[model samples]
Target: MAENKRDYYEVLGISKNADDAAIKKAYRVLAKKYHPDANPGDKNAEKMFKEASEAYAVLSDPEKRRQYDQFGHAAFEGGAGGSGGFGGFDFSSFEGADIFGDIFGDLFGGGRRHSGPSNGPIQGANVRTSVRLTFEEAIFGCEKEISINYKEECSTCHGSGAKPGTTPETCTKCNGKGKVMYTQQSFFGTVQNVQTCSACGGSGKVIKDKCSACRGSGYVIKKKTFKVKIPAGIDNGLSVRMAGGGEPGVNGGPRGDLLVSAVVSDHPIFKRQDINIFSTVPVSFTKAALGGKINIKTVDGEVEYEVKPGTQTDTKIRLKGKGVPSLRSSSLRGDHYVTLVVQVPTMMTPAQKEALRAYDEAMNAFTKNDEKTRKKGFFSK
Candidate 1:
């Protein structure tokens, strides 16, 4: 009798809109709980493993999920050996099927043994990446290129690592079973143990001839270029995600993702303070005392600013909306503060020194007149 199917989402305990990360996380947790390795002699654990694996198989595939979502298990009614079908069922008729025999021996009974091949899909490991950006590029957001040393899909054998006109055959050592059994001596007594077959390398397949290009490794070192856009106002140490940019998948699984860590370079002239910029511009002593329009440098361009008469040294001149642009709000910008630094004249000519002496004498006469007027004042006494 065909058993009724449960909702895929219900089986994985997630919503229909669950993201890839959410789905993978849920699978990881559930898979660990019911892993056959963790529950060695429990028949119920074996059943749960098959059930969870079946659920993941459908939900992970977009097309399969769409069909399952619309028609339920009935949509896959004729899918032999599918989640609810038994057409692809194994009869345990193969050499070295003892691996499955050992597995079933623990589940059903120690006396029963099976001889069949193993089949399943597994995922690869995740990888990390970093990128460097200029200070201006980070502030204004720019695209950058990077070189990565990672495993890419093999091209010679199309990732199969097999030579032309030849294909990988089922492992003869384990008879495509992917595992082997051996007897071990222990204090308890003689025991039989099942382990992955070394000859087939656990993939249950053997290559008759290796591809010359990849040297049978199935992957080659590649220099891949990727463009990354830095948003305006992105601070240092911020991370950007590039999905499916990691290493190739295993057993036809989905590829992992690439995580980019941005490191921004420093600017020579501009100093950032959140959204503000500050700098010191040197002005001549005459410019400070005479009070006139002077050209000041800014990020936008040079602008003429009026200096007040007798402006003191080190005075800050604020230019609104001329500083760093805000990353979050493009319409708003910070102010730029230019501190005035009065420069004294050096290496004066002979005539220039004489004019300074004459100005001092004229100033002394006015000082005497001011002293005389103060003595007759009532407040002075």
Candidate 2:
């Protein structure tokens, strides 16, 4: 029995020295070409798929591979590798259980483990939209009501798409399976595929006397309002997902997600990075020189900040725990960075100009007053 069977490597079109990746790659090619779902009613393709699957099962397992390499197909026969599915052993208990599932998913969009019927439930597609928010609202989470045209089952025929007291007929093209199998010749071999029936659009039903409200789609569009909660510290261009808020599912499947991307308006004074907030605060020269309390604008509102004596322009200071709240926990906050920019007075009265001269004389802000000091100083200063 074992001598009559094909070599594992030969079945997969690989060499004895082929590695795990090369083995898997070769098997995937053969499996896609001869999958039962793709080539429905083809015994030859089904036999080929099972043979390739059996070959992959042995090659993918380390111990099985070593035994095969040493003793050939005889390694698993006559109580050597146990009894009986492929190669006198249970190929079902192989190492790579998910290999076939992943491969089939890549080729057919569904795993081989379940291989649900074509007319079975399928998750709906996601719905996407943008929402504009004020910078402050983005920092401190806020909720806004959004309106969209939501699809749901039609009320006229209770989602049947047929007129009252009427029923839909089974799709003739797919025979109510809603999918059709087709084969095409490729460079490697015969390439078979499964696609949604063009006539049924995967619905598996057809309606002649369609409902006027939903036509034959079995769905209706109506205004839907949702209160979307914009999370704190959610950066611009980032999306918030609302589960089961998208298009209605097909064949009793679950609804998809609603992805809302935030479009935050630029703040006049504040800018954000991750959770931190940054802004420039204009400090009067006197306040910077003498040190005093000044009101600084923040997302939270105006707060008094103490200016250090002789503080220079562009001096940065941090207000701890005063930035945007963290997404995980609102109590965990970031710091607000304030850049102190000393403002020079543009307009001055005669009295103010005289006061400034007296102040300049008293402070001696200009060190290059004397000729000796001027000669020792920088060329421009």
Candidate 3:
């Protein structure tokens, strides 16, 4: 019906230069007014509804509208009426279900019943869970077993939800079509409105006798366990992902992924930052002043380090490649920083006080010499 010419703007009951919102508003008003349910058995109403939907669908798309404005009906029409045409536009390419609903809601009671439940192998939803690990387990890496409660395919019915020795039958209501259609009149013309069959939940099948175990849901809630390897150097708030370890899908769909979030326990001795370990080491004031070798503790055991004479408090000593192993690269590791704090004497015995007095007497000799020299210079001046 390419010869049947009617301006798209006229079909949508709008002016030639309708903005997006104006075009949308006009389409809504016209669609509701000419809906099939409002004027059943009216040919003119059905024809107008189809024409309005077609016009709005094209003009709403910039590319389609540009081509239509530039090439007229010939933009979509093939030579001598082949597969595509303007007046005979294909509604299958229209992807917006909401817009489709606005145009055909009244026709099918506000439902697009033809598009049934997704049948192709649909992947299950991704599952999220948490795991708690000890500080050592996180640093050294460990294998852990985690428990989870999830939906599993029912064993009683072999996941079909059908009782033993029986199987689900095709729904007799929709006759396996998964949909039912009814003819109605709209502003456009006669229209056949389709809707999902309520009897089968759009599966197009029905269990004549439901299974006792799963109750025909094809799945059951069960506790499951999975083993996960915690890589070394895994920090708090880190996450591990396991593919196909989540809940199984419906109708033989691919299984979803399992996301495991780790909560690492606090370490009493060592603190970590991005594969680096840090700790405080206390040193005696004598060791810091005179310099000596001191033994320090590590996860690998004790190691000795030389402290330089006159070492200041809060000085840091780094042990190269002595930190946690990298999670991304196993062979790589960070450095360890040991912050030193000089400890002053809190209490001294009489012997120590005597020794300190003798040391002060030796230092006073210089002061006495300086004082004598200054007096002699004063007299000479």
- Tell me, by TM-score, which candidate is best: 2
Best by lDDT: 2
Per-residue CA lDDT of model 3 for 1-381, tens digit only, reads 555868898787778778888888888888788867788898899888777777877787777788778777667786433236534544444432345465666556576544545334568888999899987688788888998987888889988888989988988988876666665544333455566668876567889887899999888998889999888888898888999978787557888999898898887778888888898889998899899999887656678999999999999999888888898899898888899999988899999888878878976997899999999999999
List candidate 3 stretches off by more than 4 Å.
1-117, 171-204, 353-381
- Order of models, best lDDT first: 2, 3, 1
The candidate, 2 or 3, that scores higher on lDDT is: 2
Task: TM-score winner between 1 and 3, please give it.
Answer: 3
How well is each residue in 80-114 modelled by candidate 1, as lDDT tens digits? 32444422222132222333334446555654332
What TM-score fits each model? Answer: 0.52, 0.68, 0.63
Higher-TM-score candidate of 1 and 2: 2
- Give the CA lDDT, 0 to 100, for residue 342 in model 1: 86
Clashing pairs in 1: 97-115, 97-116, 101-114
Candidate 2: give the clashing pairs.
none
